[model samples]
Target: MLLLGLAACGGPPAAIIGVDGVSTRAVDVPGTHLLPIYVATSRAASDNPHLLFSGERSDDVSYARLVVSVPPDRPVGEVTRASTLPPDPRRHFVVVAAQVFGSEADFVSSLNRDLMERPAPRRHVLLFVHGFNTDFPSAVTRTAQFAYDSGYPGIPLLFSWPSRGRTIDYVYDMNSALQSRDSLLATADALKESKAVAVDILAHSMGNLLVVESMRQMALLGRFATADRIGSIMLAAPDIDIDLFRKQLAPLPVGDPPIFVMTSANDRALALSRSIAGGVSRAGNTDPEKLAELGVNAVDVTRVTQGDRLQHSTFAQAPEVVQLIGRYLGNDGNLAEDNDDNPIEGVRNVLFEVTLLPARIVGGGRVVVVNE
Candidate 1:
């Protein structure tokens, strides 16, 4: 299958890294550094060098290392794969370097090498699961953007399943995601079992369904690591059915690490998903009270975004939202105990109330209004 640009113009950058499965070039971005991404995917391999994988499931995982160049001024935006070093200024990314691993053991060894190369206290690994309608390249580039923007001090890894990368192929994508449960679980297990300091998960849209189900299955089989290695499970704009989410949450062991649900009532994509599911309220769009009853942290971003499709990615696109996530992740699963005088503090059930400021006062500072 020919994978179109995973995201349109204003979306994440599209790029390729290797030729015939081998990385050939490295680019230099002045005034900024390259961000490396370690990726694991279940998509079937493809011969196309520009597009590494096809929209078909694979029994074994494919591993690759991607280096993305961050622009000096803006580190995140729509970027395209450049054939030469020092990409055009308009591009948000330049392919610095990449290498594909031949085996799972080789991949793990490379991961260990990358981990050791990071600075002190960089043991944290953020695992990102992309939503529906994404291709391999798009998934890689998007994860790089999130990792760079969040100021995360650890390795950023992606668990990409075979998404057809077309809105019309939602059903096909859903089946593909569901069929990759074992693959997702295997990736998570490898992370937790590795030498990484901590493992944190961030899932978007239907990816949450895969994450929730995988964790549920892992918990049922008594395969969780002790000592808090697996940290927060942040669900952004989850497209999970509320009833089904509750069912999935039920089997999880008590005292499972904090799970944060980041959602906005105005998510258009989820709205369509809700209608597709016969108007059932999605877990990501549900009220805080209901989420609190399920023993989860509800981070409502309704007011954080003013009126735009950017609301869907407010978790990553919004600077204030990125700070919130970076701070939360940096805190190592410690929910702010000092709620007093905190702009994010809210009522009992509400963990965070994110909002935005008028465009006048702080040109870029969008205020997060707490619902105290």
Candidate 2:
């Protein structure tokens, strides 16, 4: 009933800004930035070009490439989509080009070609995994917004699972996420084979469950052979049970690739999730100390009042928070040292101060000191 009421209040629009919105001509428009996003999905292909992929789970994984146009006027931490069918390139975030890869090999080859264009240090990949109630287009556009906002120069890869994209279908989304674990593992294997120097992962909400489970599977199978190649992992607003999260982390080797979990005590979405889980505390909203005991960096962002009313996406939607994330990404996931050249150094200087404590806390939108 609570989910139904929230759904009625209207969340992100469900409009399908299909492949029809793809325009090569849009790339030439003034002040438009083009961001290429490579996609690997476990969702079934749709006959509709507007929705290249549907929410139904697929037996096989599919690969595609999408180039999204970020309008010059768009805010740094926000993604503005087209309200109507024919999206305006100059004013709206639209797909400038789209391509479906013939095979996984072809996708990796294209990715390598892109990586070759960058210098060695910048030749990395940021893989994003979306949470509940996300569709294909939403995932692509969000990835573009994140990449552009963070000023990430590396490859942006999206691993999309079949999400029903309906608030009332939370159970369906969870099951679908679990079902896509094998596919996610395969995607990780593909990244390991790519030319990328490192692969940094950012998983949100229920997506964290899939990521942790995949890592657990890899651990069970002794697949951490390329653990060094895996970079920092940021789990933002994870929806997994706190106890279960601890259990999942127990199998994997600690600190192979640093793990950071962003949490907010005031996250209403996670509150609802807790209720849905029968009052079990969720990792994203649990006490930072509890999370730190598991050997992962727990970042408390309850003081950040900048996101939507739900406060579920403060990690990405807050300008200050996003800038901090950008710095962490650029610094190879270590926020212990200060970087003078970073554009957001002022914020970083004022926000984060390394301490010997067990957890980091961001308070009043100003202090974000992390405990190393």
Candidate 3:
């Protein structure tokens, strides 16, 4: 594919504006903006940030310290979607800078140096795992967009696996996701070792499968503390089979962090995923009753969307959804303690408020009202 990236730019300049405590690095429309990234990939690295991979997976994990420059033409607090990198002449927010590291220790060292420069509490990191068909540049931009929009006060990290980045390679991506499991676990360990106060893991689409399976592997291996160090596990538009999801949840140690599953019946992507798995319903599209029975917090986002076709990624685009994370789930795990009658802002309807249901229900109610 012909990538739509800006001409490569040199090092970052000094001036930056603070937008609501978010250090906004602005640029002229035709200019580039630099953002640092701690990349953990099972894919081979490229010399060019625009072409992030050679499109093949390796059995062993690879690490890199990258500084990606994306065009800030769309302004802060907004994301411009492109079917491909370097969207178009009018939509060119592409990577303009990249730096590679030779070893995991080197990458971790640089990441810690960057983290120490940030303000307090910002030492925490928000780790995002991208779903099927996402290339490295797209993953970086999405991570930046989420951080910018949420006003997240922490370092942002991305776990990019070798997805073929094409809609036709579903089976290939699934295998690639499985192949990337150990690398993801290594990333969790690296963050915890780096002195991050808390690490929040958010996975979207097929990436959720990788996240759950990797955490399960940790539990089965008796790495309970490592899994527990992950403060929150938020799955958005997960594409895992319902039965498999049950199996994955079965091994998690007791008192592990709460899992938040954001679902929407309007999620056409998950609907297609449901059909692809021989007509079995996917966990992301399952009924609230079943999710409650499983003992996880379920947020129904059918009423929220960014007017996008799939509606699968509304959690990152919808303002209310962003508010739910930034205002409620940030820093502390307070959202887990919220009740239906006293639900957090931007989280209306509590959709399914089972304490753990089938696992344990807080108040013994079949249905609860968080919002009228």
Clashes of 2: 2
Q: Which wins on TM-score, candidate 1 or candidate 2?
A: 2
Best-performing candidate as measured by lDDT: 2
Q: Please report the TM-score between candidate 3 and the true structure.
A: 0.78
CA lDDT of every candidate: 0.69, 0.79, 0.64
Residue 85 in model 3: lDDT: 28
Off by over 4 Å in 1: 1-15, 18-26, 75-90, 306-310, 335-372
Q: Highest TM-score: which candidate?
A: 2
After superposition, the stretches of candidate 3 with alpha carbons farther than 4 Å from their true spots are 1-34, 47-49, 68-78, 81-92, 226-228, 336-372
Cα lDDT tens digits, model 3, 1-372, are 111011111212111111111122224344544566677888875554446564588776677655544444454334554443223324434344455677778778888888889665557677889998776656766786666555556667888888866677788999999988888888777776686777877888999999999988988898856444566667888889989998898887543576777777778877877776899888888875677577666666666645345677776766546645653345454443443443333222222322221323432112221221
Candidate 2 lDDT tens digits, 1-372:
464457435444444434334463466678787788999999999887768888999978899888888877666678787666567777778876778998999999999999999878778799899999888888888888887877665889999999978788889999999999999988887877799998888899999999999989888988864454887788999999998998998887766676888988889999988987889999999987777768787777787787667889886787667766766776677655535553332221224332423334332111233322
Residue pairs in clash, model 2: 18-50, 351-368
Q: Write out the backbone clash pairs for model 1.
A: 13-79, 355-368, 357-367
Model 1 per-residue lDDT tens digits across residues 273-345? 7887899999877775576667676777776653235356777766556656765665665434322322222
